[model samples]
Target: MNKGYVYFLTNYRRTTIYIGVTNNIHSRVWKHKLGEGSLFTSKYKLTVLIYAEEYDNISDAIAREKQLKNWHKQWKWNLVKQNNPKLEDWYDTLRGW
Candidate 1:
């Protein structure tokens, strides 16, 4: 079975949020960082991976992505804060991959 991921990206300092799902988290994030992803993310400059959840099924990841996208901004903030209180830009972390 293939793995899928539901992830949230934020602008520097967590000013904006974007939720998405992808089978290749690394490549997808790299695209966002390069401003080659969605227009929304590129316009907002939300390239930091603040939170992510892995799923064994693509359907499950898509469902989670939809759920997160529908959440209120405050709710999303709390969710990201729970795991990434500092809201660090994760792009550098993936550089060694």
Candidate 2:
């Protein structure tokens, strides 16, 4: 079975947060960077990936994406801070396929 990823993307100013689920993180992120990923991402120009969670199954990733989406803004920030204290862009860290 294909693995899955639940990830968070934000703008340079950290003004907007976008949660997404994907089977291939690199391809999805690359699309987001190119402004063709989603309407919200394109409208907000969100390309910085701040957080990501990997799962063995796509369904689990989708469920976590839904959960994070329902969280409050600050709560989401705190969660991201826990793993990524600097809140830095994670795009550079993604492995090339």
Candidate 3:
């Protein structure tokens, strides 16, 4: 099975959060940072990587992404706070991988 990743992204204002699933978190997040990921992300400026999870299978990652997308806005933020209380941008962590 291929490895996969699910991640959450937000902007400085934290007004909007974007969730995604990818086989390569580094490349996908890099595209998002460059504003080439999606129309919604670009419009909302959600470039900060705040939360992420890895799965052994792409299907699992996709299912998790679907679940997160269906969650309430506050619920998603709450999840982020659980792991990232400060809600800091974790983009820099992808380096040297």
> Quick one: best TM-score, which candidate?
2
Q: Write the per-residue lDDT of candidate 1 for residues 12-88, one digit (tens) a residue.
A: 86777888899888999999999998999999998889888889989899888888888899999999899888988
Work out how many backbone clashes candidate 1 has. Answer: 0
Q: Mark the 10 consecutive residues where model 2 has the least summed lDDT.
A: 88-97
- Write down the TM-score of every candidate: 0.89, 0.95, 0.93
Relative to the true structure, how large is the alpha-carbon lDDT of every model?
A: 0.86, 0.93, 0.91
lDDT of 3 by residue, 1-97 (tens): 8899999999988878889999999999999999999999999989999999889999999999999999999999999999999999888977744
Flag regions of model 1 displaced more than 4 Å: 92-97
Candidate 3's TM-score: 0.93
For candidate 3, the per-residue lDDT at 64 reads: 96
Candidate 2 wrong stretches, greater than 4 Å: none
What is every candidate's alpha-carbon RMSD to the true fold?
Answer: 2.0, 1.4, 1.3
- Relative to the unseen true structure, what is the Cα RMSD of model 3? 1.3
- Per-residue lDDT, model 1, residue 77, is 90
Sliding window of 10 residues with minimal summed lDDT for model 1: 88-97
| Rank by TM-score (best first) | 2, 3, 1
Clashes of each: 0, 0, 0
Candidate closer to the true structure by lDDT (higher is better), 1 or 3: 3
